[model samples]
Target chain A: MKTKGSILTHKPSRRQVLAYGGATMLSTPFISRAWAAPVEINMLAWYGHGEPDIVSEFEAANNVKFKPKYYAGGDNMLGLIAQSPPGTYDVILSDGEFVQQLNAAGYIEELNAADYPFDDMLYGDFQKFPGHWKDGKLYSMMVRFGHLGVSYNKNAISAEEAMSYSCFWKPEVKGKVGHFDWHLPSLGMMSLYDGNGAGLWDLSGSQWKKVQATTLSLRPQVGGYFDYGGTFNSLKNGEMQAMCGIGDWITGVLEKDGAPVGSVVPKEGGIQWTESYCIGKGSEKAEIVKKFIQYMLSPAGQVKSAKMAAYPGFAITKSGRAKLIEVDRKEAKRTGQIDGMANDPITLVKEGRIHYRNIPVQQSLEDWNDFWSEYKNA
Target chain B: MPVSGKRTQSALVETTPKRLLSHLLTFKNAVRLPIIIWQALFFIAPLMFMVAMSFFIVRNYRMTEAFEMKNWLKMMGRDYFWDSYGLTIGLATLATLVVMTVAFPAAYTLAFKVSENTRRWAVFLLIIPFFTSYLVRIFSWYVILAESGVINAMLGYIGLGPYIMLNTKFGTIVGYMTLTLPLVIILQTLSLANIDRSLVEAAHNLGCRPWRTVFRIVLPLARTGLIIAAVFCFILSFGDFVSPYYLGGSKPPTLPILIVDTVKSGQQWPRAAVVAVVMMVTLFIVAFGGIAAAYRRRVR
Candidate 1:
């Protein structure tokens, strides 16, 4: 009796079957569309103290959210872009050379100049890429800029020795010199010693050979190759007598540790790298991203970022520079380091004590790579 | 009897497809699908992409659609790549051999000679180093090995001049030993734990000395574990980027450091990728060979 009753109710209602089918069709498309959100942006940058705040502020102000991805350095940033899908990021920060690379690869979109109104505010040199940009259309905007130079341990090396590029390769500095593990800067310095005169981008075949030979010659005098963190720690502990490092970090180290550290731009000058922010080509929200870039370049934004210890890309508005000076003085007074901001590029270059010029992107990268390889294996 | 046979046949016929479906639905088989998919997605796909990319020339920082062997050719011509490869392999091999040699004796003592409570503490001590970040450990070694660091500072107190060890191959070797030793000991101990204690006792009763008992009975039984541990130590020390980058001085840059510098400085991705693939393949071969050798020894 029970089996027969169950068989009688086994046939399903048409309305119930139709409702189930409709729900499946509706939910499948709805779920797929939910996975594709419109108001999200992916931002890739090297890790920095100010990045988290900037991202959060932008997200809140625009009523949109961003996922920030951080890489260790410029190379890693480029490697990630290479491996990732085209639209994986909406914004990316990289150095000048990589900006050119990205533009050439069509991985970046031409920034809308009309939307970003800070064109006149940038340093003249920052407006154009000597080799990579063409036809007066800019591919990237400068986010931050700084000079690369030597930092010395005040306890171990004399201030006079610290001022000269020759101190890096001195016999007494053997097992004490800490050069950047990077090839371009180290070999570029070597090129200067070989009489290429800091214009590493313009070195001829003979000069290039001389640079290579000089680097190999200096290998014995070299102590260790260091990245940002290691170089700073080694300098602080007096393990490294002298090192090739960024000017900003040197200033920061002195301010933090009150360690007697001095930086020099050297007689032959040094390389200046500009960290540029560009909109990714695959970004669906290019207009909004461009607006964010514009805001970053504004005086208010630039000053805010600069006060946090990052160098501003735009020429500091007179007021902004004054504010920066005030900040520096306050920092100096607190740390007891009297000459913290004296390595400003404008002053250094005006005094004829240091020189810096744009490095050709492709040639410089190739030269740097070649020099590094030889430097390591030699 | 005929009715019984017919009923059995009908039962067999009825359950044939159901039995096949149940076999397919077993827990082991159900889990295998996801594991296979994971392996393909995580390992096989990326490797295939890397190999394909290695054959292409990068133009303007983008791989061209055209296929070429220019990267491979350039790599072959470059002496630096070969030199780095040789140095990396040599250093890794030396470090692996040293680690195994030191770990075996230490593991033996911990396994057989120590009391149970002491053995637990010893194993705990072995793993304590791993609690710190790898970079911090490597940096700590610099403070220990540098000319003006603790060791030299102590030496100076005894009237000896500063001992320069930090940037030398010796410093790197010492650091590698510190890095790999703990792991080797832990793995070997786990392997040694499963050994039958009566065998060692029997060997001792048979008049074999302690050392002979270790080599003849204990080590052979734990051969598989030793090989696995050695493989780990070898791969780790061989492919180590941070240790050499921090501790190794100018003259002998290890392969990973060189690869990193090349890629970063020049945007020489192709050449860097080639070096990376070489290191990866070397590690794979060593890992597989070590396991195979252990398996052969075990079978014998």
Candidate 2:
């Protein structure tokens, strides 16, 4: 027992045993650190939000991974959330108009208003965006926004022609017009064209029918209905001379690629599509998700969103805009994000040329949808 | 007869039915049981569920369990539904006819004109396209068919056409042919290749014209396979959403697009279910009717 070989082969003295136990204790943490699994957060959102360009920095910093499920439209987003079980999604990105519906269905968690930088928003209305709060409690946080108007092939439709909704019915572009294959924005544009103005979504019964008639009148000139990708390709290739229901959010990407395309808000006005984020109701990872939301609102996150490869929208925060201007000034100027620019997004909002996109006010969503299907068939 | 002999005869009669029942459960049936179970579990059960779902109702965009005719009635009453249905049927029928006609000559060449080794190589080449996604193939057609594309550029040399083909029915037809032409040719080739050469020789020796021999001898022998191929074309074309939407531009929405629109609008899944059920019924009728017509004996 006193010899070294005998001590290793047989039971050791108390001093040797204590030394071995202390060594094992010191190495345990290093071994565990080498093999610990990163926490996974399930995200449901529109495309591009969860991509490496946006989330890699945050993931590396926080020791977590993201699994994203992407959807195309607000209704599609709602359908996916409805079909899934509670807690399946740890984080959800939603169109502002559907946040109320999400809250009503008990799908999203109530967020603390103080945790976000509402005071740092580019516009005051974003502080209390419609449908983001109920009973004075915040349910979601506004992240980014875009305007929807007439998107056109610059070669086919001149800037002047694209400035008014009436150009969609131009005789030269007949059977060359296309829709973005969503009912809300397209029908909302039709309402504005019908001269509803501020009351675009709040149409009465006769007004709703009149809006339907207006959309039908444009059907003959309509070449086809296309989803997001189809709309992009059709416009990029000149198959569609003018597209309704989309704006610079789409054309901006093509312009960056040197495609002769642009989006302009018609004199009638444009619809504003706001995107926001919320924590799922039953998510056990709420603490991490809350931190993620705060991170997305940071200036670095805002820069990533502005330069998103999928589609682009305006950064919502003041610091975010400053950061975008600092890092990518050409892009900032291209999208008119600079202060005092004629097409500046904030200036457009101040001029009352943009209306928040919303659900139907006077009729059920189904009614509008039915008319849309009818218009498509026509 | 003795009492013991009478008793044995009665016992044999009583056990005859049991022996016949045991004999019915052969190895062939044992092999078939798994497939039958699979169909019941995967196909029949889902079909029954879909039928049930069509009767349910949606409130606030949530589908709830209830048996009602409202979804069916609402969909059937809409004029657009009928319009889409008519358009879908017409397009699918047209695609079937065009594919069958175009594939016939190529199939005939492959079956009779080409060497067996060459025919096998051609079949392998036809199968190669299937390895790529159909959507990708449709997208590739864009570069070749666009107004400023390859075809149009070549036509410009002759001052021929800047044809509007990409967003029209013509484009849809092209996409359909791209999808079904090769498959139809392979099927028709296999069918025609299997026919007895003696029958064709006899017809030719009896002074039958070449075309006449084909119509009388070749067509009848290959009728089953040809009809099945046509049925497959019709079914695929009827159900395809990509060709009509991407190539045809969904200028006038088809039934499949209508189904999508129905579901997208306020999550009216019940209404979409209504559309799906109607499509299923139509397909079942077409498939069964086609099979019956294909196998029917010709009148003397």
Candidate 3:
């Protein structure tokens, strides 16, 4: 019993055990914290929605990390969700137009309406955003939106001239008009220009042809078609006198940087691009994600959206708009966030000068895309 | 006992070559297996998947497995696809010609006119551009090529007008040159520097002009490398999306851009695959043709 191996197997006395237990208990919090892994929440969103600028504060407060998978188009967003496992994403920040598709595919969870602040919404449309709810149940929550209209170089095109979509064809700006290369918004603008009004996307066959004809006619004026970066650079540098299919979402950044660029909801009306948050269908972190969406809809979150560094959108809630005005009155004023301002986006919507950017009602998206490709080739 | 021993010896004698052959094959396979596995896993498998995906259909933005030519028929039926095809071929061919022509003199200087140290330094400097992102390099050109940018400002100083350059076919070519020129120069220099000095000396001793010596002696010997370099440039330019979209403004839309548009529109990856397959076929034909022409010897 007293052999060399017996020394290795010796048990601790009661006093020794108590002392050891006390030391271990004293260090437990530090040891556990040192080893504790932060929870990971996967977010599928547009480029800036999940970036540190928007999510870092929330991350630090919640002991969670966001892993963002960003996409450029609604179709792209849908494609990504389809390819992934059911619970791969904990949250999805989708373009409002694609929320319907996401819901139709059953990729998102049915959210409780009571969790979000629908009563605080600045616009009535935000209370029941089209396609965000099904059969009296909420699915996605609208957070921010921007209008797509004629974005222009203020130095070249007078504000009055830029008011109408016909200014895109001005003889002076010939070979200087640029398109923001997505087919939907650009063709939608063309539809509005052709006086399709609220039925911009729900075109009759003849109206669709007319929209195509109008876009083709502008081909000679188009210097180039550009993505976001190109559109920004061209306008900032005065290479493009006018741009179609974009608005303050782009030019607002440039204007802040002393670029003589501005975007206006033209006389032909404009299209609204909204972005919203939804919990993924099978996310185990649905409660936390729901909290995050509520946070995004909060005054602080709305302020963040309004002042998002990547590209700004209007604050959707009344309290959020008030917070933006209080904190950054200059920005709020510049973007026409004040209630009675001439370019107030809410007023534009109220006046029926803004239509939600939607997929085509009569024609398939591919048909519009096909015609777009044809237009570019023309 | 002697007859039985002879039969056993005869059987062993017959089996010896076959055993050696098996051992030899095992050794050879050991040497070749890694590369075979690599090509099969990375290249053949993906290519097969791509071919299969092209036949599959997309429903609700999700790809479902099927064997059909619907995507092919749809893509091929579109006029824009053909237009994009012509534009892509034309632009790539133009870029290849321009790169080859522009790179030759610089390569010649580096090969023959410069000291060895200078040539080494030049090659090193040429390679430095690759350390930075190609998209960054393309963006930098905006500061130099924009309407109010450096070149235009300089043009304005001499009373010439500002010209539109940044988003034109000309701009696309410039971007392509930025991408391919350095590699082309290094290639041409290597090919030219490896020429037999004695042959060039002999041509010169016969009172051949310097330019004539280059044409008569230098070019033929470097033909293989030079042709290969041009082929590389063509391939790079043909598949490029950034240059055409960012610099060329995607006015007529190249095949690569068209592929992107096709995918972005309705998540029609099958249709995009159709475009991709066409591109791959064209590239394969061009590469094979180029190689055949490159190594072909002139019969005396």
Candidate 4:
């Protein structure tokens, strides 16, 4: 144009037009980046009574957004993780066996100890990687752990009768016993009843064969095998004479409902499972993730989580254990088992009664699948 | 030849190709081409992938690259798989029969007997249950059937004592019926409404008894709707995860529930996929066959 504005208003030559288009294309991404915002962290957790509140607190405390996905069971969460792209979740909460599998698959990143400010606050035993973690690089930190035991209808069975695994296998309870549908814990109890004890893990050849035989023997007597919530309902309604069940459901929901149910830590110790928090290997916000983990391990998080009937993963934090004992005392007093609440992890492990430690993947799968198939068919 | 006639012939030949090209590039047809391509790409491709994956082995939780017959072989051999399949098919069939029996009369009453104003409210009532969460509806059945629940509580008042129905196959079947009954009645009602009243009058005028008139005329005409309703009930009952899961005791896990457990345990993806694929194929065959049969009868 005669002036600069007039010149710009004129129709551009082909070369000039091409140059302007190239400039716009080159600058568009930069302009978009300038407006880009913080990435939202998505989380998936099991359906726990207190988990929703915990997630909300985490979101508010960090000034970060969280979208929580709930699942009916831990396996559902693991299945989701198995299918999703790595780092699709910034954080995941999983049970002990699943955490081990994730670590082995390299789907989880090793947490740098330095990033967690509250590591020293944890107890020595809790800090020791529970076989899933190795060396100094932690793969997962225990968020909660609980015992698996049997719950029986007190009106149907005596407290002393319910204290042993043999009670579930008794011929009298045929078509009346309820077992956890899961293999490891159910078969683990069977192995204990087979006189294997913690040595079940060390069994091979004919010794393992004996344990398998023991499971088959009990199969006929077993009325049903149930998952977590369903087991409690069955026990409460007296549909099952006795059930191999989790302590949480027995102590928390059933007892709270005033159901005449009693639980036991079998002479052969029951299985203990821990739920843990771990960062995915490909998470972009590793620092923030570590901060989140540290916060969960803090005393406040431990106590809040404990009140919901889950044992805090950190052994040094006595809050959860203390709360559990108090609740247990109340339950025992009501049920007239004054000393029943005395059973704890340390005592169980010290008594050489624990069945298996750090169950290997291959053996757990083989044993669980074989036992489940037999149990279902029987 | 005259110059003008020769020129006109050359011009006509030149324009023919261009006119054909313009016709081929019509806006409407061009737009429709992408939609057809997209349907094939997005809709048809995933189904093909699932069908192909069903034939392959999955190792280490990943579907293997090579084709294998292990999944199919394992499915055929496993008693657990067959038992669940048999249970699913039997339960589905029984539920379908029950639904048809109940829905026909209810639908007829709504279609012919009810006032138009009441008919709307009746249809509204039939569809209202669907607005609630499916899980909530199924769980409500537990309250009705539980040992200490409503049914047993009522029985107890009459000195019959509490009865256990909450964790049995019967309980699951009843729950499945409740979940499917509404859909069956609503669909059959729509079908009944479309029937020409003249046909029923003609059958009656021809000296047909009331029951005979209904059985011979109304039912035959409503065959398409009945088939559709059966298919809906069967599929819903067969694939039901919640009803069987919540209500069926551990003694007999449904096919969907079993697939869930297998996948969750993380030891048997290949097996789970096989179960899923079998369910899908069974559903597909039943649905298509039923539709085809209905179509044939309709055309005749």
Candidate 5:
């Protein structure tokens, strides 16, 4: 009689052959790893962090690939690094204020200030910027910079009225205001509006309470919190009369689309915004990151970055500035914000009117978020 | 030395182990082993790790070897933690109830009262929304429900003026209802279809009315399906982060969003893990208790 061993010895089953085939298919990726794709560098950044064509060309020239990721806020960036293993990121496009936080966690690599052309490559005091420097070593390079103020529809509110911070809580403008979702700068704007001399970064306990109360008070009339695209959509659709913390990027892009949006620096003051490029600590492709940064600091990169998706570049470098055909000076004058020609980062830092953002301690940041949540709960 | 004879004896002994291996790799076991491995690796392992992490305290953004009950202790003291937890459960239950109530009738119509062509078209329409991305769908609703969006614009046409709907609890509920409807309907339809038509005819022959037949005979048979559908709906709504984040507009926050807010600090993941454990435990207790009570009634 036929038995199991005799049958097995006679022929291998089709099922067995298929199982081995499936295993081989599953292992193909690992087996092919020795002949991997081109060199790839991952970048964590904000919206429109790079020009598509330029990025592609840079990849082609260096025989590498671009892997870009975006984050909404500085704290959000820190949160990503916190959750990931060390060396997961090769570079990050982050806010300058977060340099301290990055340095504290040893997330960013320290750079030699002498390696690059700082004087012509950066604006006044932007070269060896105090906020971005520690122990006489530069940790990051500032690329995009602006002030956090208000953006309003010209049809809904007068330009002069929008210039005053009180317009946010005024009865006539009630229920027409919107806020960006980022708490740090938005909270800073609130402090300035409330005339808190304690400043935005280090608020006194009483000022903190006052700020909380003000946020709560505004909640009833405030429309909703929004991101960059959401804020623009609301403005275009007439869903919001005004939004907080809109810069040239917000209004300039909308204006170019033929939407009548205007940005204003209120009477009290506005918080300054800065974006920096940081080399991640323990990056595997250190040389690629260096080359990318070097190319980005050049006029070719600066010009490309400024016009990256309607976020017009007001380049810091003299060479970068030479590439701009139009500064939109007339619109800047009308809006009462920064003009491309005259504004310098150093003067803004020296002036007490502008608040310098600080990297938040964990507990304090959590407290701030909780306070915002409470205000929303109201 | 007569080593050839000795080799044959040893080979015969080794064949015994080969027979065991062959028994283990039979067709049924071969297929099932992959599923067992997958569930163990993906589901059970992470859950175990999370539960283990919750028992430890997070310091300076990293977990320490030191054990602490402080996270558990602190969770009890926070009122919002409890509030967020309750809201998540309540909203999920609310959404599930609404879905079941609405979907059961629709499913009944589709399964019992419709022509084949009609059923096909209806199912197609139900599935059409899934063709688009969920985020896109949610954002589309954001536009339609805005203060100046389509709904208000319609109301404006009738001189009703504008009514705010976009960033409220009502908006969030509506979003969840819309998102979870298709899943609930499809599940209940499958359940309803499997119910023997003979039961309905028996009830009718016994002079039972349509409503009575449905309530007493058909639904009783479809009880398992109803439970499955409701459970799926509850989990989806309870763990939902998008609708509440975009439409809830800061009010009526849910537990998942709270978990995210807590974990967004990066160092506070252990704290978030504690919240997750509590949520899982509470849901498990409620679900199992309901099932047990149902089983007791059947036994009686």
Candidate 6:
């Protein structure tokens, strides 16, 4: 088995596993799934991406099983990939910007243009996104895109105030803004607030020191660094007023839980994160993997992905975006998270405020991390 | 096969290869074979690789086989790393002392003052918390101590100000004490219960006061158990990631937290491994060295 992340974060130790009681929960349901299918395709993807309906549909259609093991971040996914034998995983769902990194590291195979519904679905910018290609060979497929923006409980903080980077430092919002623990985008957002949003990937410059001071000054205001699963409760309980790293999904999921929270991209701009599907380099079931990717990006599959348990977000494909609009009205009432956020990814692409990170990492990742360590230690 | 006296003598003196093999092929050895093999393959083997990994060069996000001290040098050269070390030791020490102070009295009362019929029930009550999840118990401190939590809500009802107890060093200390108190009490109680009651009576007969008897007689007798309990608390609290990660905020980063960040965000596995190795070695020295010192003191 492949593993990654903080030793206990992704793949927990025996003691923690017992503490979480996740193994019993995760293992009990899969016994039947293991026996029913003769062919199994192992997938490493985000937690909510594998909606049961979508997996079961894919399973019945192909007379095969889709074994979805969840991961938290792109870095952890890469670690899992690096540790595994090439033939181990059939498919990977990861950040779109990681295609070049994966291809460079020889972790994934290039895709055929005919295999995907590029012309029928994807917008022009994402159709042949440079990150998804290497030397003109297609290496990955963009599935969804979201923003790294502030999300707040409107009762505690105004949406307008939340839409500015200053919301974190404002005296009014102090002691209530929870910083999401994922350090990379949190740093990027801070740099954007400092008007040096560009070159966030390389923050060894003078801008970094300024951002460092700003982050340290705001330390007394930060409630805690929250994980993905904890964000909803922290916001709903009013334990925090706003979070620096929430996206559409976090806000949407919170709304579903009847929390009065909304997400906003500040006027200073926000970081954009895009996810994609790719075939592993030595996948024994390349053909099956390709079929799975096709199904995932198809209109119905995209609908499932949009409404996946984690939260709602924009699909890269035109058909998928249309499906998101056509979902249940109760589902659409997610604090307006689905109202305008994913309406037009292309327009946001034109705005030039959105930033894509090079994954598994950028060239200046180590420096960026050192900068983050200063914020944390401070 | 049955053999003559000379052949038996020769086999006993210098066994043939077949005899040596047959001697080892017993049910007792066979029964223990899997456990030994498993220990060697899983535990000892991974530990050896971790130590070896601490020496390699990590270039271009992947470790290479070349010998390098860069990971060690980088880890050691930072004051930030040592800050985590200091916090880890401080948190563990304070936690141990708090738990020991509370547990010693509780264990003493249960052993001497409490009736025999009630002792088992008291011990069971002390252990009732363990039946719940350790994570749940640790997280309860967050639910009970946060600015908006139950404790502050009660204070607010009485016109007292809501205290900011969560995300502080004090909150972490409270969490560690709660987590470790049950174990300490159980260990100390077991030791206290095992002491012969006749010693206490003899000290009383010699005109010693009850408190003095406890201090002069019971404590010295229970010294070994107290040492064991303190060490257990220190090790558990020192290595814990959940308590500090949740409650310590970002103040002085804990050692385990730093190790996890380096591995997860920095992708510096070799460096992470080195930090882990250092922590393991330090704990090893503390645990074993403490045991040796305690044994020597007891002998004297």
Q: Which ten residues in a row have the lowest lDDT in candidate 4 chain A?
A: A332-341
Stretches of candidate 4 off by over 4 Å are: A1-45, A49-61, A69-79, A112-129, A135-137, A169-181, A201-227, A235-241, A309-341, A356-367, A370-374, B1-43, B56-59, B267-270, B297-300
Best by lDDT: 3
* CAPRI tier of model 4: acceptable
**Model 1 per-residue lDDT tens digits across residues A1-378:** 555557566886899889989999989966765665546778887655236555566665666677778775566677678878888888887776667667766788887555654444423454554433657777787755556666677666777776667777777787787776665566666666655654665777777777677777777767777766767667766777777645544445454658777666666666666567788878888888887777666655555555443322223234444444465656423322233346555455345544343443335566556656766677
Model 1: CA > 4 A from native: A1-42, A49-67, A71-140, A282-300, A307-315, A330-344, A351-364, B1-41, B65-67, B116-171, B249-251, B262-270, B297-300
TM-score for predicted model 5 compared with the true structure: 0.81
| TM-score on alpha carbons, each prediction | 0.78, 0.93, 0.92, 0.79, 0.81, 0.84
* Every model: iRMSD: 2.6, 1.0, 0.9, 2.9, 2.7, 2.3
Checking candidate 1 for backbone clashes, the offending pairs are: none
Deviation of model 1 at B300, angstroms? 11
For model 2, residues A116-230, the per-residue Cα lDDT tens digits are 9988899999999999989999999999998999998888889998989999999989888999999999999999999998999999999998999999999999988998889
For candidate 5, write residues A37-114 as lDDT tens digits: 778788888767744754877876676777877777776788777667888889888887877788888898887677
Tell me which of candidates 1 and 6 scores higher on DockQ: 1
- Which candidate achieves the best DockQ against the true structure? 3
After superposition, the stretches of candidate 6 with alpha carbons farther than 4 Å from their true spots are: A1-36, A51-54, A202-204, A329-346, A358-363, B1-45, B124-128, B140-142, B249-251, B298-300
Q: Rate the local accuracy (lDDT) of all candidates.
A: 0.70, 0.91, 0.92, 0.70, 0.74, 0.76
Summing lDDT over every window of 10 consecutive residues in candidate 4 chain B, give the lowest-scoring window. B57-66
lDDT of 3 at A224: 91
Candidate 2, after superposition: displacement of residue B46 in Å?
Answer: 0.6
Writing each residue's lDDT as its tens digit, candidate 6 over B98-167 gives 8999889999888888998788998888889989987788777767877778898999999996776765
State the DockQ of every prediction.
Answer: 0.33, 0.73, 0.74, 0.24, 0.22, 0.25
Query: Relative to the unseen true structure, what is the C-alpha lDDT of residue A51 in candidate 6, on a scale of 0 to 100?
Result: 54
Instruction: Residues A1-378, candidate 6: write the lDDT tens digits.
Output: 755468546755789968668776878667666656558888888877665755878877677877788877666677777777887778888887666777888888889978899986545778887678877789898877777777888887787788787878778767677877776778777777878755665655466677777777878788677667456666766777788876777887777777888777777777778788888888889998888889888988887776777766666677776666677544544423243555244555567767765421233666666656656666
lDDT of 5 by residue, B86-161 (tens): 7888888888888889998999999899887887788888989889888788888877898878898899988996
Q: lDDT of model 4 at residue A318?
A: 52
